[model samples]
Target chain A: AKAKDFTYSNRGMTLEEDLNETNKFYLQSEIAVIHKKPTPVQIVNVDYPKRSAAVIKEAYFKQASTTDYNGVYKGKYIDFEAKETRFKTSFPLNNFHKHQIEHIKQVLNQNGIAFVILRFSSIEEVYFLEGKHLLSLWYRMEEGGRKSITISEVQEYGHRILLGFRPRIDYIKIVDKLYNLS
Target chain B: AKAKDFTYSNRGMTLEEDLNETNKFYLQSEIAVIHKKPTPVQIVNVDYPKRSAAVIKEAYFKQASTTDYNGVYKGKYIDFEAKETRFKTSFPLNNFHKHQIEHIKQVLNQNGIAFVILRFSSIEEVYFLEGKHLLSLWYRMEEGGRKSITISEVQEYGHRILLGFRPRIDYIKIVDKLYNLS
Candidate 1:
């Protein structure tokens, strides 16, 4: 029923797609309530025709001030940003904006579960990097260190989510494990 | 600095504007971290020019599947939708959609803070209707009750939020009082 109205492209499950499906599964099963934030667009011009819906004629994409996704699970606030890179060895830090980093820190200060999901699309590997480690890595970059996190560093700092059939990404399993939610 | 980039219109602070400013105040004061979700737009066409940003050529607004404002406040997930009605005596229920009601219920089931901020524009009065009361009211409407909620009914089920100078709405003050937040 909901599928009829969902008009987004289905390009064989990118990280966002898999996470969206996983969130949907969680929703249907009453396990959690999560959603991806819509892309922020700056509307410059709008046209209103008689008896017709308003159409945005000119708009530009704006950088998101917060992470891509946020919600609640088992009374815990959940927040994360998802990104995929084709690089084989590392995930580039440039994929994240400064405001997003600051937003993650704010969530952490509020004792919320904050993290990032990085995908190495070349090898089909997805890893969840903890927000603490991300902050530290971002600080290192600010101090003129490496601008990317190696695959091994991600493995050490984060957990790998296994792809599933029903939920697609099964990220809450990792969330449960990460937060010791039992 | 952020004001320069915040390109949205300012028309003497509508309910949404007041809420946005209030959320910004909470964020800056380190009292809470709430934000209004961006308006969802369905993109139909995009134009990318050489050495320039991609411009959205065609887009249409889509109904939101969740509440407008949400964030983490003192480790708890906060969610709500704010609406203003000019009807003076009653606020029409049609301002809320089915998905929004369901979204509030979902947030409640997860033990998150969920509610609606109703503004009686003509009377210059605002009320914070609790989600539980909202659900009960919605059920009554489904059972063929009044389509609008009277001011007295709202007062009985919710708290009156005093408009503040700094935060504009100061809704969290009511939240703290309602939840006995320490």
Candidate 2:
């Protein structure tokens, strides 16, 4: 018998797809357990076709109440939201919601790891910004400060996640470094 | 202006209504943060009516990837699933999916609080069964044991929750007791 070959390409994969694939690889390798939340949808009607997959007749996207990805990684509860922006100056505060900030605060209060993944899509740069930094900036914004976080600020405080093969995000490696797990 | 007088009803409300009311109370009380997860749906079609809510024309309910309720509670991570079953003998293991079980195990591995709310609708009884107990029984079922957990067994290991006016589930109370939190 020949050895089975399993390889994947990241070409043309959206951020969500790439993350999903990466998580799957991590799970199979027993490295981490992470999952992208399903898109929230409001459904009003449906059609059940005989001998065919059920078809959704009507629905609309709804804003999510929590972060995008959250799960257990190396004995720590990891929670995060990922966003892609084109602006180089900074990431807009409006990209996050008041409820999400509150939720992240609660997670942090409970001694869990909570953060945001900011992707400068224009330059293909991704940074993992802790919730504390985001919350501080968010409160400052509410108190009449700038409405976004500058790229230079993120570069200083957030861990830069270098994209790679196998586990594309390789966030756990960064998490290990940040949490001193290693 | 006269203060509005409100009358309380003893007649029970639907699970959905109770849950919503409970969530509001939790938010107001600064207790554990938890919310019923919105049902996942796959949409195939939709119609945007003129100056009105977008009507969903067709959609189908999708299986959830993680547990329904998860948040930070009393300096600990809280994660659980809510289910109502009419069966008197036990809760059907089939109520949960494989992915959900995997997710719960991951949460437990991270030292987080994980459990399920089993409501016997006919008897109006609710029990908070810990994830470890549930997982053990689930594995037993997979090994050709009873397909469901008996109410008596649940009563032995699970905390019986009394539905109340505030914090309907009062799950945090059990969590507090279990973890010995102040």
How do the residues B1-182 of candidate 1 rate in per-residue lDDT, one tens digit apiece? 33222222333568887888888888998888888899999999999999999999999999999999999888889999999888988889999999999999999999999999999876677899999999988889999999889889998888887676677788898888888875
Task: Give the top-scoring candidate (lDDT).
Answer: 1
What are the C-alpha RMSDs, in order, of all predicted structures?
5.7, 5.5
TM-score for each candidate, following the candidate numbering:
0.93, 0.84
Query: In TM-score terms, which candidate is top?
Result: 1
Clash pairs, candidate 2, are A45-B58, A45-B59, A56-B58, A56-B59, A57-B57, A57-B58, A57-B59, A58-B57, A58-B58
Please give, for residues A89-182, the per-residue lDDT of candidate 2 as tens digits: 7899898888889888877876778899888876677788998999999999999999999999899888887777666667778778888977
The per-residue C-alpha lDDT of model 1 at residue B170 equals 80
TM-score of 2: 0.84
Clashing pairs in 1: none
Residue A161, candidate 2: Cα error in Å is: 0.8
Off by over 4 Å in 2: A1-10, A46-55, B1-9, B46-57
